[model samples]
Target: MKFERSEENIGNRVFKGALFVAGGRFVLRLFSLVNLVVLGRLLAPEDYGVASLAIVVIGFMQVLSDMRVNSALIAMREIDERHIDTGFTINMLRGLLIAALLFIFAGPIADYMNEPKLEDVLRVISVVLIFDGARNPAFTMYQRNIDFSKEFRRRVAATILGSIAAIVFAVLTKSYWAIVAGTLFGRFTEAAFSYWKIPYKPRISFREWKVFVSFGGWLTLSGILSYFTQTIPQLLIGKYLGASPLGYFTIGRDVAQVATRELTGPLVVAITPGLSAIAHNTQRLRTAYRKAQAVILGIAMPIGVGTALMAKELIAVLVGAKWLPATDVIVWLGPTLAFTMIASATDGLAMAKMATRAMFNRALFVAVVSTPVFGLAIWQGDMITVVYALVFRMFLQTAVNMYFAKTLIGDSFFSPFTSSWRSLIAAAAMAAIVSAVPASFTPSDPEYVVLLEMMPRVLLGAAVYVLAHFVLWRLAGRPDGFETKMLEVSGIALGKLRRFRRTAN
Candidate 1:
């Protein structure tokens, strides 16, 4: 009975945490949509592309600097002030080193890409490295304690301020410098807030140097490999396709990443702490994995498919005809986006099991496979061909990552895929229905007409898909059963609350 009560408490906590993360993500995404729309119009594609070149180098260096130690700090059990301080000190040093390197390499990087203008942009963005590195490691303490309320506030504030700064600078200067400046400002603000909110100060001590380096070594390698897997395409494009075409490619990638990051990121952040808490309990780990997979797939598969189907209309309507070329890129990359989302969830499973070496090796494989494929595509000298290469590479990488994750978790590689197949099918049907309804409703004003026509189709499609999911779950004998379990858990939580209230009385 005590065990049952404890299980109920765990379920309740998980439910609440998931709700907060999901809600926060939705709000943040809305803000991001606004930011993208404003920036897309305000800046030229060439400007964005130039900024992208600089960002690629800055991003790679930043990843190497941080080394995922902040995540490791949250994952560790029995963390102390000493651990927090050590992680903080390491992050600060790494950030300073990275900033210095970026400043030194700025000219060379710009010259390699043959964009002399990018030199200044690279130098300016280097400031973010130091700022981001100096952010308090104690910020993860909130996450480690499952206090997402603070996390949400901190992120939203940073995003809002950042978006505003970017838009303002873009309007004032009409240059890529605006984007880079906004990013630096946002990072600085976020880092300052993190330190202010978290109650920890760093002392200059490398007392735990051996332990920190040992763990961070594997994490840093994983970070570098992951950076290569993600950024190699941008590098290849900037090298071969020049700025404008790279801009188009970057737009497609960013659109897909926005969905992937916003939808899956919060879940990743929320799940790690829970998984860490249950790392030793195989049964609990399995339970969490199953539910997390189901929830992520239920949403991600439909989103990816729908985005693919609606890419042309959506981009034409939202970003204007200037972005219509991104439509093909979006469709080609959609499945990759979905698979990557699933892979992210699986990454949590690997981390929970402390399989950093396995994770590193898988990432390395992806980087190796993706880089040459990207280079080949660049050699082909076509934007669409480059996107196709990305699609193929991402698909292969996702499969490999998923296999490694399943091996670590003692599950079949196909388990998540099989579970999600139904949802994917339902979403496809919904997309078809939505697409058909909008065909006959075209009007003279393309944007307004598209929005008006799409509104009802979207509503109907969402309703049908959700209803179908529930019906299918019921027919499979899982509907009421899952809900009943939840209710039972909630009832146990209420009973405990009542007991506490009575004691206080």
Candidate 2:
């Protein structure tokens, strides 16, 4: 409820804020699952292919134009209205220009892909940029203050409204247009609700242009290279491999990335303010960075391992038989996405210290190296090879990122492994149990039967993971780490529940 930052309960606020934002993202993911399931049944793989091409173009433009000023604002210790106004004005101008270019260039991009229908889709999705850019700058204020309950409401409302629009359109048209409609509606609703959540208006100003540019210049280069590293492969697939294959890859990649991203995004966002506040304290920063990375990876590793183990049944249950080819995507990309998030913690550390050139160099190296490697995969005509290539590229990048973190935090290169050793062992155990469990159904079995087969594996895997994780932690003498922190919190929660129950009785 408070817009001003408070020093009291800093730790509590960080956890609470992360949970609120994570809760909102979790709900959004549920809505997206509904869309994927229903639309997968209604539309063909080719529909996702066409939609993906358009999305790639729009995604590139957003990366090109984004100064990441909200990040700058959050990381900066001192700022005024001038910085806020400047960020808004830049976004507004960028949005208008990018939208115009997209509308004008849709034909050429589609022509390049040899998909004429893609032109209309690209043109329609361009409006999303305008809505995104015009969103209220006040939203950042809540984030900077580590308050997120109000933002959660806006997200929930937008998700419900946009999802309903998407499902209704899918039922009526049953085409790619339904996908376009949902995206456009979601961005519009989010932008509209931004103002309703806060009572602040921004003005057009460039008084703090130098400040933002200093913070974002290297980040811009880094973002552009990062976008290409991911997008080049996609565009190549669409052009060389074919639209249907592109559809499978896109759906698979998104599924893996979205679930992992939603899991890690809260800590990534909430930690920036905390990190920035102590940027000058190297000892504290090192400890915090190691522990935070440990906590995040500890939570993510098991989920990734489980998803890979159950990729076949998950694909069959969610997208049906025609999408079975995408199963390889889920298999490799699941672990890749999880590790990618673990590596991303290093980027936040760099940003907090205002040393973004390291990030830029890292992105440049990955992009330069990955582009040709991915191209070679496509030339081999094995899309499955591309998935393998993707895993290699990401893991290599993650190592590079860890090296950078070592430079920043004075930790060893293999600190990540050391920080989360318990998690690693537990995940391995979970994977072994799940994979050793015999399949209950053949590939030709009905979806319900496959679903039944997957459920028990999921449950058993989850149980083994938790039990193994705690036992390993206990065997280690309950060292002061994330596991101990988690158990203490659980105990506090249980005590509160008991007291509340007694009062109710």
Candidate 3:
């Protein structure tokens, strides 16, 4: 009974966390979808492409400036006011430096890309980095404390405001600069609102600088390498393929990331701090890791496979015909995205063990392997080749991360894999069946009509996948009593929802 209760608790935590994340992701993605639709109509491809280059540069620098300190802070078992103050100070200083650098280099960068307008755009976006850097480290504390309700409210407000600003500006100016302006406004608004919502205030004292550096330094290294690994492809594409092709690539990557972000990312954010709380207990850690893996894979694998199969219709319907090129890109990158979801689930173990160096090493290896492959692909002048290189790198990165996570958690490599393989296989089979369905069901009506026609097939695929997944799981020795585990997860989610309601009241 004790064992059962413990298992039940794990199920509950995962379920509730997943629900919170799923809900937050849905709202955020919905806002983004609306923003994209409006902006896509208003702005030109070249406009988006030019901004994409600056954003890639800014994103890379921003990761270095922030250094994932928020995550490191949340992962720590004992944190104090001084730690928060010192972390904020460090973050602000880093942000200031990076912003200044970008401002200074904006001219040269614009010149290199043969786009003079980007200089001002880059300068304007630097302000956003500074504001984001100035955010109170107490926000991390909120997450550490598992107070996502507050976080969720702040995020939704910021997103809504930002989306409105972007759409308004894009419609008014019909230029690329409006997108940059909108982003800056939204970010600064979020920083200010987040500070207002959270209780912690910032002090410029470096009193806990030593401790912050000791932990955050490793995180900073890992973040820098990870940022480079993800962004280098874009940078290379912009440089070689120029803005047009880079624009298309950026649009495709953004669509894929947005779709997966709401689905896979929120779970990581919600689970990591909780996982840190129980990190010292190997059994608890194993349970958390396994359950998180199962849930993420169960959702992500099917979505990814289905997205790959339905990329054309989905992109056409959602983003319009102008985005047709993104469909092929999404298809090629889908496998990597699926595997990446599983790899992210193990991050809690790494943080709990203070294995920052190991994480950094893995990220460095991926960056090194991928940089040359990306370069080669760019040199070869083919988008498909670039996509294949990305998939290969993702596989390599996932394999490496899994080895380290398994070593840390004292679980076999096959443990998490076996737990979800049945569902994955079923999802794949279901995807094939759904993909074979004809598009003739749609009459020669409006575009929205065609989208409506595709919905049934998508829903049918999902239903079949879920049914087949359950059947396969049961046949595979009913690992963890699949139905019981789901019930446990649902119960926990419900309890959390109740607690949140009570707290709200």
TM-score of each: 0.90, 0.96, 0.92
Q: Candidate 2: what lDDT? A: 0.83
Model 2 per-residue lDDT tens digits across residues 1-505: 3344555555667778888889998989889888888888888888889988888899999999889888898888777778888999988998999999999999999999988989999998999999999987768888888888877888888887878888898899888888888888888998998888476778899999988888888999899998888787678888888889999998788666657778778877787777776778888888778778877887788778877787777777777777878888988898877766666677778877888888899898888888788978888998888877788788888888999999987889988878788888888899888889997757778889999878889999999988998898889888766697688679989999999999999
Give the worst 10-residue stretch by lDDT in candidate 1.
1-10
Tens-place lDDT digits, model 3, residues 322-397? 7677777888676558767766766677887888788788888888878888878878887667877878888888
User: Between the candidate structures 1 and 3, which one is better when assessed by TM-score?
Assistant: 3
lDDT of 1 by residue, 1-505 (tens): 0001122355456556665776677776776677677778777788889988888888888777655777777666666767777877888899899899889988988898888888888888889889988888777776665657776777777777877888888889888877887788778878988877455676766776666776667777888888877777777777777888888887777676667567766666677777777788887787777667666666676677666766756675656668777778888777568756665677677777877888788878888777787777878888888888878887887789778867877878887665665576677777777767745333245787777766676678778777777666677777433334445657988999999999999
Better of 1 and 2 by lDDT: 2
Q: Count the backbone clashes (under 3 Å) in each candidate.
A: 0, 0, 0
Model 3 residue pairs with clashes = none
Q: Is candidate 2 or candidate 3 better by lDDT?
A: 2
Highest TM-score model number: 2
Candidates 1 and 2 compared: the better one by TM-score is: 2
